[model samples]
Target: MATNLFQRFKTDISGIELPEKFTFPFYYEPHILSKIAAQELQNYLQSQTDFEHNFGLEENQKGLIIGKMFGVLVCQNKEGELGYLWAFSGKLANVNHLPYFVPTIFDMLHEDGFFRKEEEILNSINRQIEFLENSDELRTKEIQLQATKIEAATDIQNQKNKIKRLKIERDEKRNSFTNLSLSENGTSNCELVKQTLEHELSEESKRESILLKKMTKYWNFQIMNAQKEVDLFLDKINSLKEERRQKSGTLQQKLFAEYSFLNLYGERKSIGEIFDNNPPAGAGECAAPKLLHYAFNHQFKPIAMAEFWWGQSPKSEIRKHKQFYPACKSKCEPILLSHMLKGLDMYANPFQENPAEGKEIEIVYEDEILLVVNKPAEFLSVPGKIITDSVYQRVKKLYPNATGPLIVHRLDMSTSGLLLIAKNEEAYKQLQSQFIRRTIKKRYVALLDGIINKNEGVIELPLRVDLDDRPRQLVCYEHGKFAQTRWEVIAVENNKTRVHFYPITGRTHQLRVHASHELGLHTPIIGDDLYGTKSNRLHLHAECLTFMHPISKEEITIQKAAEF
Candidate 1:
């Protein structure tokens, strides 16, 4: 029964009913059994002395702080006894085999494993490259090459200047000879003297040209020799780099092939096949897959599963401590949907359902040129992939003969806000220009999950989409758009703060991320499903909007209060 890996619950859970189907994995609230199991596992983590890991919870913790995602899978044995299995995503404390958590699907770090052998070779290649790159011989050659180029340039310029001076002197000599011949006036000796003078001048010009050519040739040879020496080292470095690249690719492919999973029907599929031979790094090593694989292999009837963050959030992504998060889409979707849970009865994906059903958009202001509508929370400003009922669709139906794109700006699906709409092409262009030029003013009111210490401040954070998890953003400095927000606290009550956000730059989920990210406010907005805990709704509303009238050239301002 593998009692060591699977443990019985400490508290009686007989009163709780089991989930009707397996967890959808991508999104779903944890079942009672799964929650209980997670709580129990967290307790063990607090008291366990099996390993040392700094989760950055202490004020002065040392070492590289790495937060982890831990998961629990509830299962029942053939004897009808219910229990749960525990697993952590990836490795903990540089080790794959821990005391209570399930073992990794494939132990690549084992001393005798093929992965280790190949990794050693790869490391050796890296060391060789580094040594050559920093070698005194390479540095000396590079410096000599640069110095040779400078010397050659200076020598060539001097030779050119010398030739110019020589040509001027020759011109002066010809002029003097011509004047002497003219002064002789019809003397045969004078004609002979002029011819001799011309011949001498020609010879002098030829000598100067030859000298310049010889000097140039000498400098070119010196520069070429220096370049060749440098290239010799570079060629070796490039060859080794190519070899390392090929070996790394081959090693990754072999590792992918080694990572295979099993489903309920005894069907086995390799990670390569699951992701079409191009999986992201660490695809099959997440906690959900490991727990499910272990449960299936051990004849445990899978019930429900939940994954939670066990420590401090990472610098780029928003992951609160002890918060339950959905399975990452980029890595887990292909593995779980395509192969692992083929025959299991799973919960219906909530993302597929329309959040805007039975909701309506309220028109706040209407004129001949443009209009404003208060979009409800959970309503889409534009048509989404699965849901077609949106503000754009509704507005289009109302104004069939209207020209250009009906909506000028957009709000997120979960954010309730005032959206500006244009009825004509000219109006749309003018309104859009106002927004682009930063003339349009906007204010959003939100309820934060925690109180902010500062009363008023500004936040500047660069943002980019989390490629692995769609709709989720990361604070990335490398490839991100600039996003800024100014906020002032309105009131603090019941451990939550209400604040007004004035975004200077519009970006997807800018305010939410700026509020939740550790570098920003470090307090997520209440009911923020992506960055914080989910509630009945995301407590953010676009309360005020001010822009110039597109046709009339008059300023217009509209305001609405949040329902939260």
Candidate 2:
């Protein structure tokens, strides 16, 4: 079965040379062989009837649509024949087994497996919880308990009011009898009348106190009974939920243990061990890990590999059809780097190299209170994880006496723009306040990859960072912050649209995402490596800025033209 998984190339590859090293799974340009294999697999997906899955490519396709990530690994067999293997992330068509793709590391969906058996039990517990939560008995008991509480409170208050009125009447009688006794005509009779009135009042007060206690006791009993009935249903629901939680934890641990991968040296490590016993969901199920695991076990020498998105993009993340992407950092990085790719020569990580090397920052404007500089592309506003040379560091070194944080605002490392700097804490606060108040004006020039039909419009798409892949953003309406950009077409030449962007909100990757997202312009900025294809440099530059000077109290404007 594993032998047939290696697919021979369908196209002539005599002119192409194999790569010297395996691909750096985190980032790289797809090798020619990998690209050829991906095209062949895409062709098969378009015409084959081997399986059914809704990728949401059609105008009216039904069912739960999900676009998938597909990968191809170029390899050489023992016979020295060059070929490639295909794999998809997760299960396809509700099953892990398919015709030509690599199989999963573990078959959790096997009918006779422990996972399925435990899943059934978990499902049963879920059903019981749902039934109890939605039962008529539970609903009726809850409603009854609430109504009884309200009725008891009202009745108890009425009894208290009645006792208060009775006490007031007794006091009045005592007052009237004392006045009669003060008169000389009936002194003896008044004394006897006073004694009798006192006794009667005492008896009345005692009776009223006893009646109030009785009323309170009765309402307490009623409320207690109603609450007990409601708790009966809730107790069962809670118990079942606890059982489900424990079972789920146990099952997940067992499943993780079964998904062990083998490296080139035949060293085996489970997903739990790789991720320190806390792997994210679908950790070992990605296309890269599956392909590499199969290749190592079957003795296929890996040469290069690439993964690409297919079909419509997901609502949250931006994934253009047929666009190559890096393997996810959160899920695949730990597994591949720590266990699977051991002893394999691979490309060096580009992120480790400082991109700001040999670039100089040009001073655009300078004054006693503040200044502005023309930041070069691939230069960080502040220090990064591996590299410490940045615009802020340079400015701080130039002005050692400068107070507060020198950098007032930032530009993306890939963006060449005007960065503002403050010389003192007061100036920094004044300039930063202008940004927060939306009083500072900024305009950027960009070259889009595709032509824009509309001349001008506003884009209001919320954005948040993709937790699975840091530095990459997602269009998440639920958890994202508001991001807006207004753009106007400046010119169109060579199938590219040059435009000016006025941002209303400053979010991470605001303009890049708004340019490429389907809901926005649907045209990525040229050389936007995160959102679009990589190029020589990102063609986005901050061309203009307007704000009031802190010391001079006069409005100031600075302009810089983009080199591209």
Candidate 3:
């Protein structure tokens, strides 16, 4: 008789002895096929590190006394994702005898619940489509609104232009009329002609009066019409601006909602503080260092916090006084906080009484158009109104006849190196054009953490500032602007590598970010706050710059030794 395929898969082992009698149909299966499937699943898991696990078979069964089972078959996969099999009492069947049963059973079970999976996938796709459509609609509406505002602004500007043109035309007409050799110390030229004609004098005088009245009326009409158009245009501008603000507000709400939904599971952050809470740092022009210190400490009075951080006050003086300690006789908490914070000069420094007189800075090169200088670290490249000892100030003093010495480029405050200066506006504009066109070349030397693999190669990576963390950057593949740099290893010591960098783009903190994050070298220039590994000093130096001279039309190259 042909046995049931599933019956061969089962074995009975209630004890050391097989069961004497069986009540249920004993249909057991080995996990040989399931183990094979698990192996494939392991390969799939290997592709995704965040979703990881181990999969292996761990079981052995002994058989069967004369048509009776003594051992059992067992298999298990972690996570309880798969746990379905049968146990029975009988002679143990070899896996070869029942190949079709396990596959058929697993397939049947999978099909039983497959529709739910398909429905879930379809739902996810629908949600994404809906979100995309909404976003497009909002964007289109915003663009249309902006276009309307721009049209209104343009109309107002055109009206003003028309008014100016009308004024000019009227003035010219009036000047020509008054200077027509008709209104002078002598009688009017028309009057003199009329006098000679005698009988025609009365007729000519009447015609002249009529002509003057007509000209005056025409000029007044034109002026009034131009002024009316100007007023109408200004009114339209104001109305359109109000409409733009409303549309902008709508767009902001939609965008903020979308952002919140997508980032629900991400790090939580807030744009504005709660009513009574103060932001750790305020936004825009009122970034008070003292208030920021207070917020960082997280100790706040509701009224004081609201006023200082949000530029708002409590409803009444009583609430203000109760919640926040009053400042003498004033009811405003922000005013009190600002005064209290400003009074503490913990971070402020006093002017030196008889400070050391700065030495005259060295001028590497100078001419009629430009000057090149070896700038010392910690010295300002260009002088501020308050600065007395900057390289730019010194150069201006040395060439007293020169005017408006412009800084063409600059090195960082902690970086000491060579720089070029334009002496006049023409040279400044020429040099600026060269920089904008990427015709100038800048190179630097840096000591890195470890020796890079290639003795000499290139690192093609993009960089941008991390505005949130203040003076840091991350690998932003999606939104970052493009930046490129070429690096070559100069020398390899026991562990550290000396590398030379030539930046094709002059982005802020480009070289430091590329070396540390892209190359995984973690190399930073000495004294740099964002990229340096230690606080002692950074290990980078601006060693060279090469460009064409704006006036002399000669190739110029400036070089400096690494500062340490």
Candidate 4:
């Protein structure tokens, strides 16, 4: 009967067949609920070209823009009837508009209360900051004076060099006198010439020193006074900024305290309690979560959820218009995870099980210090939260006497590759040091979803976790760690490209992000579950590894070519 509830709902959109259920956390296809919601959003956004599908990108730029995500919450109200609620990434455009979307978490447009008065002051402060920043006369003067000082310093140096050249010529003339024939009383001709030159050089040196002092004093006085004025303005700007920050923090805490959330298990907590570990910034503020939160609180039964992007793509991210993206992991995962109703069917991950449990592991190389084995695809290199069966446990069962961390470096569960295991503490420490010191070389062979034009290049994109969505990474310039990847195209087959990846820094999902990100390779790896579409398995393999032997100190390189 529960399954039939979802089956009963079908749209008149002729050729488009939505999936029976929604996407899971790790794997999924879209449901009809999402499609219907997307259609509505598309129709609405088309009327307002200014509305953004992207939630956060509100800056000016040039390029073809893609859309951001908007979601729908399908639920049964108190009458046991099904209807859907709509929401956007950050906020909505014109809540009063027709087609009647769900209300945002907080009534930001409320004319009365603390939100209005305090927000007015905040806006005023922001204007002041903008005005001061745009005032560039003082800054321009500082630059101009700096140029003057550079020119002055250059002139002084050139003058001193000329004096040195004169001194060298004088020394040569004196030396020639020693080898010259003496005139009358063995005296050199033009003795007065040497005295004249010496006097001239002395005058020039004195002039150079005096000019240097005067110039230094002049520039220092001007520059220091200019800098002091600039500092004064900056101090005012910073003070106002601090005030705004404190006020914003207070407002958020107040709001969080006021709002409460409910879960399917009949458990409930105020937004503040749920965010006890970290202060809420953008969490639970998203449209889908907000809609769900409202339904569960009002005693509605939720059946399905779907979100779609409807605006131009942000310049920084690769978002396509009308493309359906799952609910973000950064902002919504924790809230939804604890809050989703229990009866709803959740998606499942295949890798959550030990696919290689009964399968054989091939030993590529072995010794007393360590063992190098070819890790099979779908086999986790180490134990995970759900899957306890892994290469570590397998090796531990075989060699109970082994010491230290067995896994030197880990491979993703979906990837098959060469894994190095240390037999003892010394070997483990030694092998880890090689990785830390970057002496170890690793190469990944992957098939990409698109053809790459460049033969070889280096990708330097900073990365940070998308706070709204868990496990999904975004190209973030701020609050991001440095990640670099070097790649060379190996070949192209079936309109697909293959490349060898050389990662310079080890960030989680670095290779995947760098490959798919528009700023990086702009090629999604074939079958990548997180950054790209789902497939039988991720088309990535840690095909080669090179490191030093702990005891023998010999350089060892192992290769396991990808089967695909």
Top candidate when judged by TM-score against the true structure = 2
Query: Under the 3 Å rule for N, CA and C atoms, how many clashes does model 4 have?
Result: 20
Backbone clashes in model 1, listed as residue pairs:
none
> Over all chains combined, what TM-score does candidate 4 have?
0.66
Query: Sorted on TM-score, highest at the top, how do the candidates line up?
Result: 2, 1, 4, 3
Q: Where is model 4 more than 4 Å wrong at Cα?
A: 1-27, 43-67, 75-83, 93-99, 117-254, 262-269, 294-301, 310-323, 340-360, 466-470, 476-479, 552-554
Supply candidate 4's per-residue lDDT for 101.
53
TM-score list, all predictions: 0.87, 0.91, 0.39, 0.66
Better of 1 and 3 by TM-score: 1
For model 2, the run of ten residues with the poorest summed lDDT: 180-189
Estimate, for each residue in 1-564, the C-alpha lDDT of model 2 and write its tens digit: 757899999999998999989999998989888999999999998998998889998777777898999999999988889999999999888889899999999998889999999999999999999999999989999999999999998988988898899989999989887776776667667777788889999999999889889988998999999999999888899999999999999998898788899999998999988888888888889999999999998899999999999888987778989989999999999999988999999989888888888999999999887899999999999999888889999999999999999889999999998999999999999999999999999999999999999999999999989988898999988999999999999999999999999999999989999999999999999888778887899999999999999878899999999999
* Candidate 4 C-alpha lDDT tens digits along 309-354: 6555454455545655666665565666655544556666454656
lDDT of each: 0.91, 0.92, 0.45, 0.71
1-564 in candidate 3: lDDT tens per residue? Answer: 112211221222223322222111111121243233323323333364432112111123232212211111122223322222221111114221122122111111243344345445445555654554446554555555556556555655565565566556655654565565455545547555544444443454455555556655654565455545444544554555555566555543433332110011222222222112232232211212122222222222111111101111111111111011111211112322333333222222212211214534556777788877877655666654454556666677777766554778876544566788888878888888898899998888887766688766565555555443333555556666677888889988878788888877776667777776534344544444444433344666677888899866888988878756
- Candidate 1 per-residue lDDT, tens place, 204-291, comes to 8888889889988998999899999999999999999999999999998898788899889877899988888888988888999999
Model 3 residue 73 distance off true place after TM-score fit, in angstroms: 61
Clashes of each: 0, 0, 10, 20
